[model samples]
Target: MCSLLLVYISVYFCILLFIEFLLPFPSQNRRHNQQINQKSSNFFFVFQISFMPKKMKSRYILLTLSIVIAIIAILASQTLFSTPPRVFIHNPFDILYGIKAISYSAITSVCSHHHHHHHRRKPSHSKKKISICGDFPKNIPPPDTDTTSYLCVDKNGCCNFTTVQSAVDAIGNFSERRNVIWINSGMYYEKVAIPKTKPNITLQGQGFETTSIAWNDTAYSANGTFYCASVQVFGSQFLAKNISFMNVAPIPKPGDVGAQAVAIRI
Candidate 1:
């Protein structure tokens, strides 16, 4: 029995060895395909390291680097040189305001004015636009000719209103033009303001005697206080002659109630 068992075991061992070496029907083909795939993969790997970079690879790398740098630079600029976006406006009126402010400041810097220099004469060739203010001596006649006629007010006859300020309001409403308003002899008792719309307006008085626009108002005072000026002229090309502004305040102290009285503002 022992001899028989030993022979059987040897046969079993031989069978197992044969099965281990034997490939399955499909697995036989798979082995050959796997060899080919391995060979191909190795070849491509070598080729990539050797001759695969024949097409502009260096230039491509450089371009990619430059793009990355540009992105970084843009990000850096956001932190380093960031500024508020400018506001753009297309209004025609605003254009005039911005440019005129800068231009006038530049011009006025070169020309200084003082009290003694108030009575400067106009050019010889230029035409005279005369306006009379205050109460004339009742002897001078108002000019009828058109040359000096347009800019003068109350030139036709004596002022009908109780005060010259009433006449100013009437003129401002009657016409928006800058024609002169000549004030004939009168002690005007009121506060007035020549609006900015009335450009090129001029005021002439009868040597500040009969013709006078006097109001008692001040800066610190309330809106309608005597501290405010009797008349405030804002329009440009403003010319005043023989006009004397007086404070009608009963007090005479420095900061008196009538401390503010602007006779004429050009």
Candidate 2:
């Protein structure tokens, strides 16, 4: 009986040892649990890397896009609305601020800029103009001594008009292109108005005293406003020589005295 009991104990111990070994490495359930745990950890790792939310990074991307679009819109507007440029300048600064285009006639029409420049453009041909008055001006004389004198003298001859008004009436008929008006010695009384379009005009007098334009010294003379003269010159290149402009008839009163009788409208 003792021998039988010993064999039984040995068999029981062997069977328990076999079952423990199977549970460690050979059991399908244990291997399946290990595989499930590995798959769950891998899923968590992948989700953290791919679906992580970052508000700051998203805001940065959106801001960058917005800035780029704004810059594009501004540049496009300047191109569409701004005037065309006169010169074909590849200015480096234009890279920062888009440049506009313009035409020559438009640019020349406006005399607004203090210092104008041209880049990669052809030079414009400057036009020249002048006026020379002769004795027999197609117009009337400025004024006459007892109705026998003249004022505006041209290349032709002195235009002796009864009144200065008649002389001015015919000025438009005269053409003085880069010419000099040779005025003969005479007390010609008249006021003149020259426009700037007629450039390079030379108004030469026969003599300073003889070629005199006399208007009332004051604005309250005979013709209240037309006391002496009301001449306006708006020419670019103008020349006046040997001409005496006087408003010194202020004997007792001063009407248009201090004012400039001979006005020069450059």
Best-fitting candidate, scored by lDDT: 1
Model 2 worst lDDT window (10 residues): 79-88
lDDT of 1: 0.52
For candidate 2, write residues 1-266 as lDDT tens digits: 22233345545555655564455543545555466556567587444333323532343445455455455445434534342332214552453343333334345546534234343254646755443443243434343344222345432343344333344443443344443444555644555656545444556676787765554433444334343354445655567788766655545545534443432224
Q: For candidate 2, give the lDDT.
A: 0.46
Give me the runs in candidate 1 sitting further than 4 Å from their true place: 1-157, 160-162, 171-178, 223-227, 252-266
Could you give the C-alpha RMSD of every candidate to the true structure, in order shown? Answer: 30.0, 26.7
Report the number of backbone clashes for model 2. Answer: 27
| Residue 146 shift from truth in candidate 1, angstroms | 5.8
